[model samples]
Every structure is written in structure tokens, then in C-alpha cells.
Target: MRRITVPIALLALLGSAVPAAAAQAAPPPSIAWTACDPAEEVPEGVLCATLEVPVDWSRPGGPTIELALAKRPATDPSRRIGSLLINPGGPGGSGVDFAYFSGSAFSPAVTDRFDIVGFDPRGQARSHVVNCDSDLIGAQYTQLYPDNRAEYADLRATNRALALSCRELSGPLVTYVDTASVARDMDAIRAGLGEKRISYYGVSYGTMIGQQYAELFPSRIRALALDSNMDHAQNIAGYQKWESLAMEGSFRQFTSWCDRTEACALHERGALAYFDELYARAEAGELNPDGQPLPPEDLVNIVFGYMYNPNSWFELADTLLYLGQGDGGQTGRGEPVPNGYLPVMCSDFHFDVGAYPVLRAIEQAQNRLAPHTRLNPLAWSDLASCQNWPWKVTNPPHRLRASAELPPILLANSRWDVATPYEWGTSLASQLPSARFLTYDGVGHGTYWRSDCARAAIDTYLVELRTPAKGTHCPAVFPSSPVSAQAVPTVVDPLPQLTGPFRR
Candidate 1:
């Protein structure tokens, strides 16, 4: 999933085309941008605009699509150094939101250097948004039924209907939302900005977009920073991690944080004991924090939901703790799992479980690997969506290494990031010749390289095109990520892990 924006003044990207790669992989695609409302200006230094593109690049001219876009101008136009486009991680992340939320952070020095930009890619967020209607809503990525497998068969049928719905609603657009096409869109923005080369900073899936763009338009890069790395070469199949492991990963990180605290509910002699007891209570169908029957599996989904952003870590711990607390602590709500987390998490990735059987099969495989960790919502998400998706499941290639010719790329990962494991980023970095690795031994995703030294290194790179030493570990807490000349974000104190599930 991709949030397609960064804060910058303005520029162009196509809205509605599908990738020519799907039709013919020979030559890469190009983009043509439609006029967004450029004459109109938003409050302050921002502007609102749109890029009209084809839904499917394969049939580029057949149908048109629109991408919602925004830009935050450089504070000093006199010293502006083209545009610095930003894309957040989620395939479903909102770039416009990222700019709105973090665009200011890059201000003063960074904003003076480049205009920050953000946009929602087609089929997600404000672009060509996708909706599965009500019936498909609750079924979401669930195993289906009232926790019944047989009922899941029916849910599978419903999921197939979702594909049909997408086909009908999205038409030519659904197929073109791949990274390669987005890369082409990047080129369009570069052209619109009137810059021969484009500078960019992408996180998570955005990193993959940056990867594809660099691969296709090597000469077009001025300066680039890729925060979290993704193995786009892996395709749709290896995406199995979307399942329970997603949640399990978060659980491990969250529980480890709790292990250091004595009062933490699940903080038995350690996190493991607390977790064991907590699960036993959920398994026994005891009263959950909300007073509803703890489905036992809801914890997985909740934890899985929490792992995506560092901002949620504290809430995640408290939420989990509250869930396992029964009616004694909080209000007597009905269920343990908060109802809100599902829509946000499920919407982040379009698993389209209707067509992929391989993901479903992976469920049994997961149990074999980590039986105790299996059945959690994250794992279940990996499996359930595949079971019901409309497409066939096949192998997606893995990128043990990336093409060596890209610009200086930065790989950042936190040791305890539940959403993305640290090793994966390092392994991906190991694959690229022009990349460097920074490990944050602290908590949270993308924070591994969040320190000022790391920031200064990155900031200096963007402004002067430099790279940090090949392998460096930022032991002290770092800033969220890097920017031009960043010293590092200093917190008053190390945030403690919020209390969570109390094991026996």
C-alpha cells in the first residue's frame, strides 16, 4: 500500500493509467499529466492539484483516471533546488496526509531547498478509491463466519464478488496501480516540476516505488532517500507475511517492551509468561476488558493493527492490557478488540483474498512453523484473504539484492519494529551496491536511523549527495527518519512500554 504524497509546492503525476508491463514488458511506460487546479491556491504555502492518468497503462488511452495531489512550496524560492517528493509506506498510506502531518517538519532549511509534494495513488485513499460495500466490510480480511471455517466458505464466495465489484467499479484502473506505473508517474511529476532529475524520499512500499523509478530512470535521480525497504521483486505470493506473522511480529516487539516492566499485566517474570497467561484467559473465553467474550483470536488482529506506526506503540500496549483486564479496569464494553482498528489495517493492503489459494494454504503452513503464534489476526489475515481472493496464487520473486546502479539509498530499521523485521531491511540493503544500513537498537519502525547524526548524514546527502559510513548503528534514540542536515530528535525521556496483557 502507498501514501502518495510529500510536502512540496507543486507538480505533475498521471492519474488513471495501467502499466504497459502487464501488456508488454519490453519498454517501460511513460506518463502524461492532465491539468490539476493549479490556478487555485490552498491556505499558506500549499496548493491543491490533480493528475489525470489512465487506470491501466496497458490500455493507457482507453480510460482516464485522476490522482489527488498536493504540494508545499519551499520557504525560499530563491534557493529552491527542484522538488523533493515524499511517499509514506502503506500501499494504502495517504501521501497528502503525510505532507499535511510531516511537511512542516522539513521546513526552514529543507523546505528552502525543495518543494515537498504528496498524492494518493489510484485505487487507494483520495485517488481512484476502492470500496467493497457493506457486506464485504465486516468480512474484511477475517477467516469469516462467526469464527466458523465452514462459514468462511460462504465468505470466500462473497470475496469473489468483491473482485467483480472492483472490476465493475474500478474498470481499467485497478490493474495499473503497481509500482512500475507509479514510477512512471514519478517521471511525470519530474517533468511537471520542470526539473530534469527528481529528488525523492519514500518509506515502506514507497521505497519500492523509489526502487522501480531509479531502475527505470537512473539518470533522472538528483538525490533520493528510501526509509523502509520492501522486496517488490517478490510479487503477490510471498506476501504471506501479511497474515498472522504481521501481528506476531508486533506481539513479540510489544511483549518484549513489557518484559522490562513489573506492573505490566502480561509482565510475568517476563513478557513470555505474561503473554502465556493472557492467551490462556482469552482461550478460556473469560471476560475481556470490554466485558465481551474475548474471541481469543482478536488479540492478533489488534496487535497486528498496532504495529504499523510508532505513534501507536503506547496505545497498543494500553489497549492490549485493557483488553485482557476484563470489566474491572475500563468500561464494560462488549468486545476486547477495538472495532476501529480493523478498517484502517484491512484497508492498508488490498489482499483481494478471493483469488489467491496459495495464501490460504499458507495458513496451515504457518501453524506448522509457529503453532503458538498461529491463529492470531495478523497470521489469519495472511491466510483468510488468500482463501477468498479472486485471483490465482503463484510465486512472487524475492530480491535478495537490488539493482546496483541506483542513487545513494539509505536503509533504516528498528530492532524491535513489529510491523517490519529489522533483518529484512538489512538483507535488502545487502543486496544493493549503492546502499547503506543504519540499525536503531531502540523500539519502533523506521526509527533505527532516526538520530541526528543519521539525519545529518541523510540531510547532507540530499543537499550535497553524500552517504554515511557503510555500516553504522545509532545506539541512542534517533529522530523518526532523516532529512537534510538533521541533527536528531531529542526526547525528554525514553518512553516506557505501555502496560499490556497480564499473564497469570
Candidate 2:
């Protein structure tokens, strides 16, 4: 699951278009956005504002970047607590927008009690997007069972294509995508709002932002809930290693779900057989209803895309049902699938256009880490993009550990999340002596959105400032149904010709 930091997405555009001086100067008494007609699509209570912060804090007198801010006044102004920040996960994702869109995403209590705030960290959507040249999507390496040198060569060409694409479109911000800048922006936002302290909820990459924010401004934090925690404490290599294993485990659970579900397509005991066959079909240029060739990884991406939300689980099952049935027909999958997932999946994490070779080497390194495990397409894409990206190593070996003095944080994780494994949750949470780790025996990525237990625990923390006992690690509590119980079952001809079931 390639989650973006929703610091932008959830907030949308809420705050006012004030002069940049406010960010450089002291904050206003309370947050407010310019009055405009709120559209049906926009959140009702959202207010838009801008925070003028130094583009480079080191050069305070230098040029400034507009830090987007969105605020939703406390549901009950009489009981308004304070500005509560929300981030939706992608470092590249939107957070400022979450303030506008997170109405229902947050638990009822959190929304009712605190004034929600979100912002796009610099270099993300609506906050100052960074780009490079070339169509990284078309140039990406597409090896099905990337087994031999021949496949690697083909992958190389595609990787090169990706590099050229990202490089051409990118400018100065490419080198400034580091999280420190984002943390600084958060501080500026707090200043702009005249808040002594900040409250935050971050997921996926958002957790990394939260950790950095908390670490940098320990005294500035009122409360924080970081879900699907990012391991800034670990090296990028280690991060990818753990994520690979996580993907393997999650895919296994996915297969198991297929076996148990009446709606899933691969019902046999060894669903791997069916998967192999399906990939082979795609390699031979299978077409879906959209008349586009369905690459194997494309198939994987569609399935991987929705693993973040239980709301999307049935959609995945439905897709699988079609894939299983479509593979049987001559036109491949008869109907189109994944129109929405493809664009973002293809273009979102694109690498720089010139660093094609770098992308290839990065992928090579990542794939070598777990030669036998299932790898997330997005996971590999990150490494590839980083390799080709113009960004430099400011905190490349980002090993910022949580401080012992911070208040107890509640860390949540899904055992079957391909993006963040349970190990990461416990591992990082362990570093923060004040933190209490919670696990859910669920599939897909992230907390909340679908899991009630996670939402309840997080909401309680956000609203009540209560948490699981210190060092009180909760066992993995999954939905009552087995992982695969909700998946549908179908009979697809297994590939008997396939060798020892492919490891990945």
C-alpha cells in the first residue's frame, strides 16, 4: 500500500490567503480562512489559510514557501480543546486537505472535541508540487517472474526511462524533499495558529512526519497518535527488507482469503498455482474489458492499491472474481478493471528521468534483500524513485529515535499490512518507553478507516488523552472472521507446468 501523507489531502484548502509575513511573524489569535462559497464537494466547516515560512529555515531572510493550512473549527466551540493536526500518511501525500476531508475519516469523538487542522508539507500536492521530466510510468521495468539476465536487461531499459522522465520535470524541490523541512513547516503552522502545543494524528509516512515533529518539538506536542508507524530509526535498506517480508506475509494472507471466500477466484488449496497461471496469461498479453493489456504487476498493483481499506476489500474480491473468470475467456478479462488505480499507481512515485541506472541498481539491491519473498510494486517503486530522484542524503540514514521523555504514544499496526509490518510497530514503539503498542490481526495496510478497535483506541487517545497502559502491548485482535472468510472462492485451472511454486 503506497500511502501518501494526507497532511494535504485531508485538509484540502481551508485557511485564508493572508500575506506570507504572518508565517514569519507571530501567529494570529485563532485560525480562520477567507470566506468563499463552500462547494458540495468541499467540507462544510473547513476554513483555508496560508502560512508563510522560510523556504530554507537556515536562510530565514531568504525566499519563503507558502505552507498550506486548513482548519475546521471545533464542533463544539464551547468545549473546543485546541488545534488538532491530522496527516493522511504520504510524505508525498496530502495533509492540509485532510482537515477538509477527514470529517468522517476521524472517529466521532475526535471530530466533536478538537478543531481539526491539516497542511501540505512542502513539495507535496497543492503545497508546491515537485516534478521531473519523462513519463516514468511507460518506462518502468515490467518483468513478470524477473528470473534471468535477459529480464534484468529489459528492466534496466524501463528503469532508465523512469529516470529521464522524473529528472526532466523536477526542479529545486527535488533536492528538498527531506522530512526536516516538513517538521519545520509544522512548527511554523503551530506558530501561525498561536498554539503553544500541537496535537496530531499521522498514519503511514505521516507517522514518520509525526515522529520527526515530536522529536524536534517535544514540548510543542499535546498528544499524538501514529498508526502504521514508519521506522525512521531504521536504515532505508532495513526499511525495505522489513516491508518485503511484510508484503510476502500479506500476499499469503490474500491467497488464504481467496481460498476461504465464496467470492474469490482461486479456491484451490494452493492458490499460488492459480496466480502463476494468471501472470502467465498477462505475460502473453491478456486484455481486460478496457482493451488494455493487463500486466502481472498491474494486476498486483490493483490488488495492492486497495489493501489499505476494508471498504475496498470487497472491491478487490470483485476484481479477483473477474480476473479468475476472465482468464478463462479468449479476450482475457472481459471487462475493464482498475481505471482509477492505474494513474496514481503509474505516475505518483515516478523517479527522476536521468537516474534510470540508479533506479535499476536500487531495485537490484532491494530484490536481493529478500530473494524469496513477495515484493510490493509500490515498495520497489519507492526505492527506484529514490535512486533516480534528485534529492540528496540529508537524513538518508534517518535514525531518529523517539525520546524517553515524550508522553506515552499509542502505536497501531495491521499484521497483514504490506507497507508497514507489525514488527515495525512494535520495534519503534519499543524504542519509546512511554508508548503502548497495539496490533490487529487484519489484512491490508494502516489502522482506522475500517478497524473499529483501532479507531476506538485512537479516538479515545485523541479525545480523552487516555491510552493503553504503558508497555501494555495488545495482542493482535482481528475481526471475528478469518482473514479469508470474506474473500470469494472460484476455480481457475492451475498451472501444472509451473515449476516449484514461485517463491515471490
Candidate 3:
């Protein structure tokens, strides 16, 4: 199998060479720790700090940027391992806040064994942020998945204006907010911590940073656990197809549950047909939920958002029922729109603005193949933004590999994830020489924080360096059954599994 041979190939490749800078670099300046502002949503015993890293790694002593940090020291220092840095995805998500939020909830064993560390990657919130026009961003977001050639032209113009605005507001820093730069920033943090190597836990987009770090400084990793991965090897078309199919797959699973379970609020004999009607009405602009009418694209996005977790399916069912009745209220709970997502994603991947027609045709073909969940506006928006982006990416798309001398890493993902998708995690695992994959056969974007099985695997791996056997699957906690919807207690949104802690 390719998976079996990849590690062997990577080991040979890594063992043959080393990065000269990483090999001979001196420690950067020490960080100054202080009490976090009381007004900030900080967990107990969390101290704040800042590290100065180069905006451009090539010129280390040139322009500098401050990266904010948060730390929860190990409860039992005598038994403590070194610092374990954590990033909760969002190329934009604030790691500093994540330290306070997730760190506060870490199990005693983990808190006692390792210092929980988190940092806002350069150009993210709490760091030197990339500011854009709030009004323009809100207005243009989700506005450009046009229905006609004329509309497409409008989309292009809108994108051009938005792109120009972003560049004007963001300046040169926007071009440098790539994953490669973020990885270098991680190394700076590692050296500042006085650790020979550091452990890491990265979720979603955060995994990209982890992968890059492992490739650039393979010998500097103590341990790594990547959950809900985003495959950096995917080009624009591949990215669109993968995400569209994943979203559709999750939608189909939700409908299947409804077909078999009476407890689902939207349970009916022809559930898929009912959904088709909703989609048609949204497309025709004949259905308005609450006061605003949702375009077919926005409607699909709403449904896709609920696909993040099975527990939220009931809410999704209710939303569909309301739409069926020509009533509109709030849809089901959704993930917070990322502020830093566009800047970072656009900067990392290559997108061709001139290829919009061809790309849209390809997307349409993919949609036809998967009609149940078509109109993937998320992919469209990302590609469009990148096409129109005024800045160049300092770190372009690339695969990742760990040096043979680095510690083996762990990866976890739910089998039915939509946001980052399960296959992305598998893809990442295959590419890395020392990666072990853990699968959760459940519904959610992330697994480690919510699933005991996943958490146990990660904990054992971090504490004892015991990798889970390949092909291991964690059983789902909530299995589908036809029961009363009201009888089952609804759970709080699991979307916050990563984003809640670091939203400052």
C-alpha cells in the first residue's frame, strides 16, 4: 500500500538532510509574562505573554511583529513535561484566547502533565491584525455566487473592489500571513520557551501550520496531534470537489437518519423530495425565512452548517419544517464566520481569477453528480476571493513530511465531518512519514475534545508516546433510532469545540 511505503520513503528523505537555519539558530529574546487584563475572558491561573518574530523569516532582524500568547502552567510541575502548544484552526482563530477557554477545561491529568500553551499566529487577532472594511466585508460575503453571466460580471467587479479594499486596509502584511510564516512563528515560540522541542495540538486549519512546522523543523517536534485536518496538497479544483462531496455526503446521511427515525422533526415519507422543494423555492426567490429571502446558495450553506454535528439535526429538521410552512426565523446554530480565514486561505493557495468560467463549469458538473447537496458557495467564495486577491502568497501550496528523527504524530477526525472532512485527515496522515490516524465514526467537525475515545488516544500518545493502531475507529455515542424528538435532550452546539476559547 502507498501508506505503508510513504513513511519509509520519507524517513530516507529526511534522514539525508537538515535545515541549516533550524540546525544552527540561536534562541530569540525571552518573552515577558504578565497577568492578563481582567476584562478579557481568561480562565483561572492563565498568564499572558508576547513573542517578537520576524514578519518575514528571510530577514529575521528586519521588520518585527508581536505574537500574543497564553499559558496555563502544569498543576504538578515536578511531573511536568515541556510546553504543549495548541492551535484551534481558523488560520485566523486566536490561540491566546483558546488557551484560556480550552485550557480551563483540560482534564487534570493533562493539565498536571504539561503546560498548556496557545498563541495568536502573526497577523491574527491580538497580534498585528489584518483589518478590512467591516461594512464591505459583510456586504460582499456570500453575495457573489451569481446566477447569470451578467451577475457573474457583477461578482467580478464586486470582488475587484473588495480585493482592492482588503489590500488597501491590510497592506503588505496580508501577503505574509501564509501558513509557512505561521510555522516559522511557531519555531520562534518553541525556542523562546527554552524547550529543545515542543508538543502540539492543532485543529482544522491549524493542522496546516503543524504540517508546515514538521516539514520545516522536523527535529523540533516533541509530539503532535492534528484533529479535523485540511489537506494542503489539494489545488483549487480538488479543494472545491472534496469539500462539495463531503458536504453532500453529510447531508445525505442526515436525510437517511430522518427516513429511519421518527424522532427527527422533519421525518417524512419523502424527506429528500421535501428538501428538493425547499431548494427550488430558495432558487426561485419565492421562500423567505423570517424577513429575508435566502438565495439557493445561502440555503445550501445553512443546511451544510448543521451537518457539522448529528445532535444539531433536530434543529435542522425544525428549520426545514418552518421553511416548508413559509415561515422564517433563525436557522439552526452555525459556526462563526472567520475574520482571518480569507486572508490566510487566499495567501496560501493559488487561485486563477481568469478561470472563473471554467471553474464554475467544473463546479456545476460536480453539483450535477451530487444533486442532493449542490451549490457549494463556500468553495466558490474562497476561490473567487483568491482570484481577486491583490497580494501574493509568501507560502504557496505544498505537501508535508516529517524528518526521520522527529517523533511520531497522531491525527484524529470524525468519519462524517463536513467542514474539514475526514479524508483530508487521512490524506495528511499518508503524506507524513510518522503519522498515526484515529477515526471517529460520528458526526462533528472535531473529535478529541468531545469524544472520550479520541481524547484518551491523544492523551496516551502525548503522555506515553503510544500511537493508536492504524484503522482504529471510535464508535459513535449517539446512534440513530426512531424515537420522540422532544424526549431526547438537545445538546449545546459542538461547533464551539475549538472556536469558543479563542474569540477575542
Per-model TM values vs. the true structure: 0.73, 0.74, 0.87
Q: Candidate 3 residues 326-386, lDDT tens each? A: 6553333222223566778777888754655675686687688568777455666677656
Find the 10 residues in a row with the least total lDDT in model 2: 495-504
Which digits, one per residue and each the tens of the lDDT, describe model 2 over residues 348-382?
23333233444455556655653434456666655
Local accuracy of candidate 1 as per-residue lDDT tens digits, 374-404: 6444324433544445443221234633455
User: Residue 435 of candidate 2: its Cα lDDT?
Assistant: 75
Off by over 4 Å in 1: 1-43, 107-109, 144-152, 235-250, 262-270, 308-317, 327-361, 364-383, 391-405, 448-454, 476-504
What are the Cα lDDT values of the candidates?
0.55, 0.59, 0.72
Q: lDDT for model 1, please.
A: 0.55
**Model 3: CA > 4 A from native:** 1-27, 327-338, 479-504
| Candidate 2, residue 11: lDDT | 24
1 or 2, greater by lDDT: 2
Rate residue 38 of model 2 by lDDT: 60
